[model samples]
Target: MLILGAFNLFVGRLYLIPSESMEPTLNGCAGCDGDRIFVNKLAYLGDSSPHPGDVVVFRGPDSWNGSYTSQRSRNDVIRGIQNAASVVGIIAPDENTLVKRVVATGGQTVQCRAGDPGIMVNGKKVDDEFTEKPMSNPVDPATGSQACQGPYFGPVTVPQDNLWVMGDNRTNSLDSRGHMGDELQGTVPVENVVGRVEAIVLPFGRTGFVDNPDIQHN
Candidate 1:
């Protein structure tokens, strides 16, 4: 078991989708059980980087709910077990390490507008056909007023070596768009990426290769 665990940790690992952040594309949404996915750690062993539309597993920044740091808040033995279990995909390394889809890579501009197929990258509309609902902000259902208002996020360019990521369930996901004011300005550094999700590995009914969206920059 240890050997298999180590191999998985260094080469490929499995992850259980614990939230609805990537719903409709990767499951784990409200009232639905999550999917287990295979993450290929060697995917970028040749110094490759994440591409737009690839679902990736990564260690989020400090401001991303302190997922890594939270371990420090746990009992030593429990934390140790969690870490060991993570080697074989028993649980996530921490709550902060997450799975999200890359929306824009370095040097690209991305924005979310108030309309159908709401996301645009590098001035080109992404073919977002996987989502069940059109992108819309949370609003007061009674009056239809936006629950919160601002500059409407992005229209900002991703910095070199950084990536703009989001969930397939756009409206409910707190992704790069929600982290705009952080130290990384809502973009995750390329170095933080762990690997790309290759396929669903559990619940036989949902096992399959994850589809990469057709993202164009015009």
Candidate 2:
């Protein structure tokens, strides 16, 4: 058990999906059991870095705090226990961690405009097959794209060492797009990434490796 705990703490860990933000790609809901996923902490070690289309777990930037609620116990004793359990992957750590897909990396420019079929990175339309099917949200009249919902934004260049991220669920996700007013233009620092989500490991019926396609090419 001690060895397993150490491994979980430093190598990889299991995390439970708590919301539908990444829906269709990762199953999560309010009341039922969410999909359990394995995050590979070693994925970006050495010279590797997250790339566009890779789903990752990361610490939310300061601008995102308003949307998060901590799950730590108020009592010292219980909180300590929870902390210990989290080390072993028994429960999620009490932190503002979020999961989303990388939309554009450093030096790339991303945007959505009127009549665009999907998001554009470096002026090329990204393939939208991975996004939620039959998008139900009211399309943004300004952008005319269901992907943008109501906020058509950016040709904004991603800062060096930062990442532009968004959820596959688009309309339902309060991802980088929603925090564009911040200093980093809603981009997450590469340093804040906890790990790359590699696979779904729980809820037997949905177990499988998560896809990380080259979204910028299409």
Candidate 3:
């Protein structure tokens, strides 16, 4: 038990999906039982960094706080227990941690327009087959693709050592796209990443390795 706890603390940990932003890829629902996943803590320990299409868990930037609410208990006793349990992967930490897929890495320009087939990164169209279909907004007649829903955005360059991320459920996700006006241009600092998602561990029916395709190549 002690060894397992230490492993969770330094090597890997488990996290429960909190919302529907990553649907169709990762199952989650507000105030409901969601998929539990394993996050590999050592994925970017040295010279390695997050890459496009890698789903990661990170602490949202300060500018994102207004859009999220913590789920921690108000009771001091229960909250303390939850915090302690989190240290051993027994429960997820009560923090503003979020899960999203990397769309553009540092120094890459990413954007989507009304008539585009998909998001373009460094001028190449990204393969976004993993995104949920039939987006929440009306489809654009120009391209017939739900890539940007209604509004178009970006061509924004990601800062060095940062990442531009979005959810698989594009239309419902309030990811980097919704924070374009903030500092870092809504890109998340690489250092803020907690870990890379390795696999879904709970809810046996959905158990499997999460795909981390090289989106820019396609």
lDDT string for model 2 (56-142, tens) is 999999988886787898999999999999889898888888999998999999998776566899988876678887663666565
Give all TM-scores, in the order shown. 0.82, 0.95, 0.91
- Model 3 TM-score on a 0 to 1 scale: 0.91
List model 1 lDDT by residue over 94-118, tens digit each: 5577889898899999885554245
Task: Please list the C-alpha lDDT of all candidates, in the order they appear.
Answer: 0.76, 0.88, 0.87
Off by over 4 Å in 1: 30-32, 66-79, 113-117, 134-151
Candidate 3, residues 73-109, lDDT tens digits: the string is 9999998988778777777776789999999999899
Minimum summed lDDT over a 10-residue window in model 1 is located at: 142-151
Superior by lDDT: candidate 2 or candidate 3: 2
User: Model 3, stretches more than 4 Å misplaced?
Assistant: 136-145
